[model samples]
Target: MTRSDLNNWLIDLSEINSIYIFSGSEGLWFLISVVAFVWFILAIYRVEKNDHTSIEEELSNPEDLKNLIIEINSDEVDKNNSN
Candidate 1:
């Protein structure tokens, strides 16, 4: 209701637990951050391991190159229409 009431409520809430120990919400956030970081690193490693071919090698076939160009043009047209 009042600012002082809100401040006192916050102070009481903080005082309920010691700052040195991780609260449940803090621990959950830390776990999520660690998992996300590890997942990102693994994804990068997996991509590097699986992707052995260069761009030139991938598009060496004429048909593949033509299809890629057509796909790009279609995507561009769709984007332009959206705007």
Candidate 2:
């Protein structure tokens, strides 16, 4: 069949909705972007809907949590010598 006939047979102009399939690395990127978008939306939804511990109740100790703890004199340093 000719190119014109093939085109006409493949795509119908009367259809209200058209679906296209993407291929190759460009398609991979599109898929990745869609996943990332969904992930971000889910994260936002969870944050807004989930209940979390309050700041005052959560952080009672200054150096308790691994991530929140600060480096406080691991080695014995001269605290008396101010010079």
Candidate 3:
């Protein structure tokens, strides 16, 4: 067809909902974004489950652990001094 005939056909197609395919592409983008968001949430959940020990609890109970280390170090120093 001539260029003017093709242009006329395109103009006619534009009169109806030209957003039919455009909105289809938009729906696809929304679906992809949703899937990516869900994947990110699941990854965070898994990491939290695997390594979610509380730092506050550990820090709160440090006195006993510190005493144990000090006792061990004293024994080591005594042995070295004796030798």
Candidate 4:
């Protein structure tokens, strides 16, 4: 189908009536509502916690990590002031 034909089909579908709510058993409705509420809360939390950090920040923050044996050996040699 062409782009114009698909666009016309979508426009025709937009005229149909759609009820967003379902009037079913109380237990089913409650379960669906609870799930939807939890999902919305989690989405909000992730958005708040997401931050962009630069690569420089990550590379410079390795002091908390223990250095390897080679680093320790180099430090000892430097302390002794050997060639």
Instruction: Give the candidate number with the greatest lDDT.
Output: 1
Q: List the residue pairs that clash in candidate 4.
A: none
* Candidate 1: clashing pairs of residues: none
Leading candidate by TM-score: 1
| Model 1 residue 68 distance off true place after TM-score fit, in angstroms | 0.5
- At residue 46, give the lDDT of candidate 4: 76
Runs in model 3 lying further than 4 Å from the true structure: 1-24, 53-83
Q: Can you rank all candidates by TM-score, best first?
A: 1, 3, 4, 2
* Deviation (Å) of 60 in candidate 1: 0.4
The worst-scoring run of ten residues by lDDT in candidate 1 lies at 1-10
Candidate 3: the clashing residue pairs are none
Tens-digit lDDT string for candidate 2 (1-83): 33222345466656624334332356688899999999999998787655454553576665555445433342224454543
Q: Give the whole-model CA lDDT for all candidates, comma-separated.
A: 0.75, 0.57, 0.70, 0.61
- After superposition, the stretches of candidate 1 with alpha carbons farther than 4 Å from their true spots are 1-53
1-83: candidate 1 lDDT, tens digit per residue: 43232334346575464443333466788899999999999999888766755676889999999999999999999999999
lDDT value for model 4? 0.61
lDDT (0-100) at residue 62 of candidate 2? 53
What is the clash tally of candidate 3? Answer: 0
Tens digits of per-residue lDDT for model 3, 19-73: 3334436778999999999999999998886665564455467896688779999
lDDT of 4 at 52: 29
Model 2 poorest 10 in a row by lDDT: 69-78
